[model samples]
Target: MGRTNGGGGGSSPSSDSSRKFMEFAERNARLAGRLADLKVGSAELFLQTTEQTRMALCISDPNKPDCPIVYCNQAFVELTGYQRDDIVGQNCRFLQGRGTKPEAVSKLRQAVETEEYTVVDILNYRKDGTAFWNAVHVGPIYHEDGSIAYFFGSQWDITELLAARETIVENERIATELRHRTDNLFAVLAAIVRLSAKDTDDAAELSEKIERRIEALAGAHRMSLTGEGLAEDKSNLRTLVESVLRPYRNSHADRLEIEGGAFDLSRKNITPLGLTLHELATNALKYGALSTVDGKVRVDWKETEQFVEIHWIENLGSASERLDTHPPTQGSGSGSRLINGVVRGTGGSISTDYRPDGLQATIRLPIKNKVSF
Candidate 1:
């Protein structure tokens, strides 16, 4: 969580020639003489209210072996609980605690050594040795000869910001769990609709279909607990296809046929496509050509240069006239409609071909990582 920003100690007016500036310079010279080590300050600025803001301001000597603290504002003193006298000449490491990140410290060391501005988050310790999170902004200063001058650093307490972020993450987790529950509910509704068709259906067949669908719905919900993490696990493409076809593997029935050369596909795309595959298989057995043994079914898929195309071609030998000479339109049947919905939802394209040979449903999906394309 390291981060960086701008601080304003780079320069001063190099061309000041006016009488007022000259008089101010003269006063500054006298002040420097009286206090050689004291920092120069602007009277107007010191009187201003800008110093009391939420930001902490400090200056450091980076070239020093310990990077000693040179100056700190009143706000910095209050935020850190270290008065100017107590902090001056002390190594900035006094602000660091056990929880401070070593990587962040390395980044700061590099930025200061290189005399460049860098932003990072580091855990810091207060005078009481209590730890706090700080957004530290650091930059280097240079002399006229381009030699190291000193390091100027500022810090912002961001413990509250980090806490708020944690809260948001927790809320998001709850929302995701709720969404999965809702999706399963929809799956149940879809399963019942598929079983209740326009034609007369036997109770035994209905029960079997319902049971299969319930298991499929269970599969959808089970992916998280049993399946790999949403974005982490590697997926076997062939194994994925097999998993989707599991519900249609009825021994006594001849409803569907699945054939393909399954390679390992990326998990990101396969899971959604898998669910859509199940919905399609369910629909075919209920209302499509899979309803009768004379109704032959073929599902074949092959990979192309940029995508994978799965062809679900259903043929009705003598019942073509009864159903139609063409493939039924999506949404006309609960199963086709379900397939269409899942296909489109997963960034895939689907089209039904009307032919006397059979009703062909082709779904084309990307096989690469560029989903936006």
Candidate 2:
């Protein structure tokens, strides 16, 4: 026996789906190319297509008073939370508020007056008084008579895009700071180790010396990173030298003497000068004035209009009791190369003469800018 269903039958759902697909295909064939290629061939369908798009689009009459908006898409209404009737006759400037930049507004005004194409990003407000960044593009539409009939304008709410850009910039800044910190870490470690290894053969003695030099470098590194203490004031030219030599002073305090007038150094010059000065004191401790009780070291500087000269001299005994009679052809080890780098890096020249009395080194650097006297 056959059984019958209770509901009455209607057209199959597949038939309805087919009809809708055919309708879409027919409409799509009418607008087969890009909008620019079609050129508003079907004005009503073109306007309807723009209304369906997500981007806010509008049309304004150039011939009308105040160039009022004559048409606006559904997306524009949705984005601004404004009714279609309320927006059709108003100027787009209604979206602007106190937060809008006057420069951007002026540019928009000029573009409209000149009937030229322009794109600008401006701060705008919604109907609910909420702010957003809007990127707007506007261009003139010409009629068959070669006269401007309407202005076509499109806009995008770019608030999220601007926020994303700001986040990327902030991340880049943080990455750069981290890179500098890493570089400073390795530089401090390498400098102290190289300087300490030069003076001794005994492992224990070398270790002790390395530890002390590392401590000094750590102090300088802290100052450099935190911009504290002497490092905060770049105007003090002799601060780096004083810090490097402070540990080498004896109980009598006559072993080191500094005689330089107050002057400022640039930030780029500070680290190089600090490292170079540290290396110099290390050398003095090994063989020069600081090695002997009676020996004394004098560091003096003089400034001219175009140059600054620094003199490092070790006064060791009288001329009759001098240790070395002739200057060495070259300085020893990587210390010499490091000092050379510092001199060359700063666009300066250096010379060393091992006189019968003591070792004399002179560095002449061009005056970049003298912050103080």
Candidate 3:
């Protein structure tokens, strides 16, 4: 009876051991099934998030030949004007067009080959053949083994932003140009007022002189700014000179002689040239050649390939007797300084000669190529 009881005890222990083993196995199986469900749910959530995002997203399979696109979200389709079916299984380079920069393409290509992240502002075309600037961000999606699984690209249409930036730059440029022009105009006016005050203490006389000088400046400004009905945005040298001297020519046409072939002067140089000529003529009428009858002023110009040389000569005739009175002090006055400043601004040079006969001036200015405003 003792042996049989012992054998029964042994059998009961073996059965208990087997039962515990089965229970452990069952617990492990249930845990595994729960873990699998969790993984599937996570993947589905990721896919949903990507699909719903506004950012244009696309996935290219590197394992596939040529790394063609395998997945693209709805936003990508809308941005590129391509259907999902048409986009899938094609390389992303199809978006490139003639305007696309080769440097950008090379950078993108290198990034993909080396599994590096990169961003570029590249020109791209849509399915409808319209061009747009695309700011693209691309990087590698790696697998758990630290190997590249896919290349992920996100793109944004930055065409409008780029256009706005360009417009701002252009506006700033125009503002700068206008400010420069205003400053130059004001400088010339101030010089005129200061110099005119020195010549005469009479307010009426100074006023008349200032008015006439201002009118000459205004004429030049009008011609330079408006082109004076010329098709091009430039003035003819002869035309500008004749117009500036027109006031002096009215009373004595024989006293002023203008001789020059047609040479184009850029609008930028017109006002300065006009101002210089006006100062010279005013001096002549006051104390030089134009102070007496039979005094003659001859203006002429010659042009070379790169420079236009202007000559202004005066014959004092009977007025030569008064040469010692003024002594050709043209280069030592405020008017002379103004002339120098404006001429130098145009990249030109001027020289004055005080002879026993009269005053002579020579100006050489560069002929700049025509540019569109």
In order of appearance, the predictions have TM-scores of 0.46, 0.49, 0.64
Per-residue alpha-carbon lDDT of candidate 1 for residues 1-373, written as tens digits (9 for 90 to 100): 1112223333232332233345555776787676555454655444354466557877776555466787777778987998889988776777887788899889887766445568998899889887788888987554543444567788898889999998888778757745754674575466445634432377776676556546665564445334455433345565666667755665414646768875545543554456556666655565567665677677788888876888878776666754542222454654456546555655677887756655677878777644411
Better of 1 and 2 by TM-score: 2
Which stretches in model 3 have alpha-carbon errors above 4 Å? 1-43, 219-270, 277-335, 352-362, 365-373
Candidate 1 or 3, higher TM-score? Answer: 3
Cα-based lDDT at residue 121, candidate 1: 88
- Model 1 compared with the native: what TM-score? 0.46
Instruction: Report the lDDT tens digits of candidate 2 across residue range 183-224.
Output: 755765675577547756788987876675466556555544
Query: What C-alpha lDDT does candidate 3 achieve relative to the native structure?
Result: 0.78
lDDT of candidate 1 vs native?
0.63
Candidates ranked by TM-score, best first?
3, 2, 1
RMSD of 1: 10.3
Runs of candidate 1 exceeding 4 Å displacement = 1-118, 121-136, 140-148, 152-174, 177-211, 233-236, 247-276, 279-298, 303-307, 313-331, 353-359, 366-373
Quote the RMSD, in angstroms, for model 2.
Answer: 15.5
What order do you get sorting by lDDT, best first?
3, 2, 1
User: Total clashes, candidate 2?
Assistant: 0
Better of 1 and 2 by lDDT: 2
Deviation of model 3 at 10, angstroms: 60
